[model samples]
Target chain A: MSLHTEYSGPHAQARSGPQVAAPPPRNSRHAAPGAARRFLSWLDLKAAPYLLVSPYFLLFAIFGLFPLGFTLWYSLFDYELTGEQEWVGLGNYSELLADDQFWKVVVNTLAMFVIATVPQLLLALMLANALNKRFRGQLFVRMGVLLPLVTSVVAVAVVFTHLYGRDWGMVNWLLGLFGIDPIDWKAERLPAWLAVSTMVDWRWTGYNAIIFLAGMQTIPRDLYEAAEIDGASKRRQFWQITIPMLRPTIIFVVLNSTIGGLTLFAEPMMFYGGRIQGGSDNQFQTVAMFIVEKAFSNFQYGYASAAAWLLFLMILIGSAINFMLIRRIGGRK
Target chain B: MTTLTVRRDTPGARRKRTHRGGAGSRIWDATPLTKVMLAFTIIVSAFPIYWMIVIASRTNSDAVDIPPPLLPGGNLGENIVRVLNDPDAQFLTGLTNSAIVAVSVTVSVVIISTMAGFAFSRLRFRGSRVLLLAVLLTMMVPIQQMGVVPLYRLMVELEWTGQLKAVILPYLLNAFGVFLMTQYTEQAVPGELVEAARVDGASTLRIWWNIVLPAVRPGMAVLGINTFMITWNDFMWPLIVLAGNPTVQVAIRNLNAQHSTDYVMIFTGTTLSVLPLIVVFLVFGRQIIGGLMEGAVKA
Candidate 1:
């Protein structure tokens, strides 16, 4: 039965039985050795690939996929971290939808996403375009721009939080040069969003630009040369040729920014001094922060799971919407 | 399309255009304006980090002084000592734990990624296509956020909370790393080379070690650096799981919360946390840049 199954296996041709073919009479004494060799080789061929790939699948199954499925299961029950679980089908989701604070967090998350991503991407695009031009110290400039990325997000938030200090921040000090009053960066909603967005953009803009620069490098030079020959201005060429050719890269970047922006947590959390409240009024509390607050702070494990699902859905909807919008860029003549 | 066809018609024309370096090169040439813009960009990119250092080195009074000091001060050593000795922050422990987690995660992710990459790219096996697609799908979902609840509960059940194991286990296998390595291996290792190695009766593992690993070292380096940077800077998960025992990011949070008024000490801790990565960046900046661009295009 084992032999039959082996014969019918996927690599049967390669692993065909040595016994099926009449062994040459001259080498009949070596049949056992030959079969052993074939078996070893068969095992090598059949097992090595799975062995090579098994670590990833095994680890991901335990850490990634299992938790993903369990999150959905957890969301269906009224679960708490204090070891209580009651089945309440969609109860958490329904309560979350009507929860005023939850909606505010969703709004804050989306507001910050748009506030951060739109200008961040636009600035990165322009930075990439500028960097695409041949320069003498190209590598130096690139490294300098990417320097912020090396700093931890918490570190960036710490520095920016101080810089946005209501009384004596350098930013407010700079504003005071123009006689403008001090702005309470954490107290107000819009200012808080701007402050957090700045932190996000400060860290990521250069990284995105480098990716965009990479994409720009892959576009054939002839297309630009042709557009130049046709008397199209540089600005027009960028809009017409560069944007169209960079569609795949744009899609990749936009989707990445969508997921990242919606998941804004550490910057705002640290901005408000490491409290998950985001502010006393919950002014800058992102959905991610809200989820953490619910699960860890309030011990609403099931409700936070539902919020996690909603954040996932928000990412999907945001990516799809942005993908559609990006596809239209340079689509028309 | 017309230009593409024209380039195909005269394949060397683009190369010739670049050599001519007249009007055609103008498009690629950096203008004075471009140089100025890039300079401003570099400064803006670097200033916050510079500001961190300036404040870290200054006195507490200098930290909030009107028109905040923009230059380094002599108090840096004193403040760093204060941070290291701070009982509440546990800054040194945070730094050491972060280093351990980052190195372990980077090494594991790179090795696992390279193996899976070689298998998916060089080996012909059933379910390869479907499995690779699954890895790609895995990359799309933010598993950390989605799985936080159950993962936390699992950790709690296992009694691993506040341990480095809780912080490090989830990150040991990264889908992005696998996807990157697979793309890289496909590009870097030729099919003919693998076939030739096989013809020499090289076992799959031998071929991987001798042929695939050597060829894909650059890809591994890229993945390793990126993974290290990410693991070092990872905030939310570590903050959630290891809140008591804390990584560097969480330690900074502790310092910020506990000593909100101790600007110099806080900045000192922040600077110390970032200093090692800056050193790594300085050493491997070129490879990091090249590998990132290369990975971007391939992926």
Candidate 2:
């Protein structure tokens, strides 16, 4: 703990500042001279901050940074759990491009991404607006909105699967009461997409609403008051004031929802009975689920790595486009 | 910032055209139609969870009935006991494993993020700004599936592939946690306090421990609960890492896989697994929501 013995380096305790080194205690007058020399090196200002902050960076290098680099490296090899990895050098990428299943999964992912994220953001905005009002039981309503988000994805999926069941499911039953024919939610493409998107919307709408609400709170109340004074309808004020002011928050919600939608795995996986292939027809298998299937189920690490890289690229591009879209929309104002 | 006032000031009147309430009044006041819409939305939001509990309370015969029970049945105790006693599910073990992982990860993240966030926010260290930027940049990069392949390999190399520590260790270095603490510390703890502590011959560690930690309790509470919820809900990573030793989510998956048709048992297991979180949310929902909203505002 002492600098005198631990760090005998030249610049260890040779600080020019008055408070750099604490003087020896006056009560320890009879104490040995060496005791005064032995300052607590743990208190060394130059080294202490680094020591305090090192854990996060160190862990990041191992778990985060290294894994990012290694994913790219691993994609080039024909790797397996037990077998020796061969130097494939873009072979995996070529195979992924040619794989029809991969393209099908990509199409499915994009469709589901749009289905889930679009309505989710729209609904979230509306819900945020509604909750931002001066209503009785506001806390109760807010908590109710967040209920889906609090529940585990596994639980949500399980419950939804029951609700979307062919015969006894509540959804079909409800449809029946409205004079509509019962549709098989899982087997059919459109029904399946709707069912899954419903799950996504149910879980996330409130969360995004909270974020939107936060953004809305920051907008000065005077803006709304002024708009009201001008005889603007509530709808007009919403379109003109609320939406424009919430641009940054909307962008955040959009980008995050894109990322979340693209990587959706659990809800679909559990809905389709815990299989990587989302359904018998593979109508809802996301790219993320496909990657897991390739790596774990099929034992094709190289192929999985390639798919993973593709997903990452897609997200990067998606985020860039989202950012530009928001910027353009903001500029139009 | 002005405190929000209830625009409707009429105590006894149900309907009033309050001209003095300002321009935002039309939007703020709830119409009969708005009430119906909001009520419907709230129902849609909370109905599934209510439905889950209903299913859990029903017997298998009651559960699979043509008109599935909309109300809670009398078989709650029986189903819970059956789910707990199921040979394949291992509900208790999975709960234990999840708790271990969640608690460990939460504790570690709070401590590490606090220290790192404090340093970045308060300490004047060399390359601090660059390091902080690096931390922020990591938040944007999605943890893709390929990264897991390499991460799994790293765990294998360290001979920690199947352990809870493997799951706990990587999550401890959350970029969001670091960013959350950094923002919280900047606003909550004054720079002059840190400077005062430094001038008093107190170590940086002491300042963080005795001063910064106590000051950021609310932030830490939010961070801790969020981390716990995430860790508890984590499925894919735990499934991959703890391959043989499945956590609660994986166990629930396996439960459904083996039983295949036992809806009552599956719902029971799901309910049991979800109960602890429901409890946590009920207790700390306000703090968690407030913290998240506050963080969003700062961002």
lDDT (C-alpha) at residue B147 in model 1: 90
- The prediction achieving the highest DockQ against the true structure is 1
True contacts kept of each: 0.73, 0.59
- Evaluated at residue B77, the lDDT of candidate 2 is 95
Worst 10 residues of 1 chain B by lDDT: B1-10
lDDT of 1 by residue, A1-333 (tens): 132333243234324434423333444555567777668767998999999999999998999889889888888989656678899999999999999999999999999888998899889999999999888988899999899899999999999999999999999999999999999989889999999999999999999999998878767788888888899998999888888888767888888898889988999999989899999999999999999999988888889999999999998888889989987874764
Clashes of each: 0, 0
Taking chain B only, the TM-score of every model is: 0.93, 0.88
- On TM-score, the leading prediction is 1
TM-score of each: 0.92, 0.90
What DockQ class does candidate 1 belong to?
A: acceptable
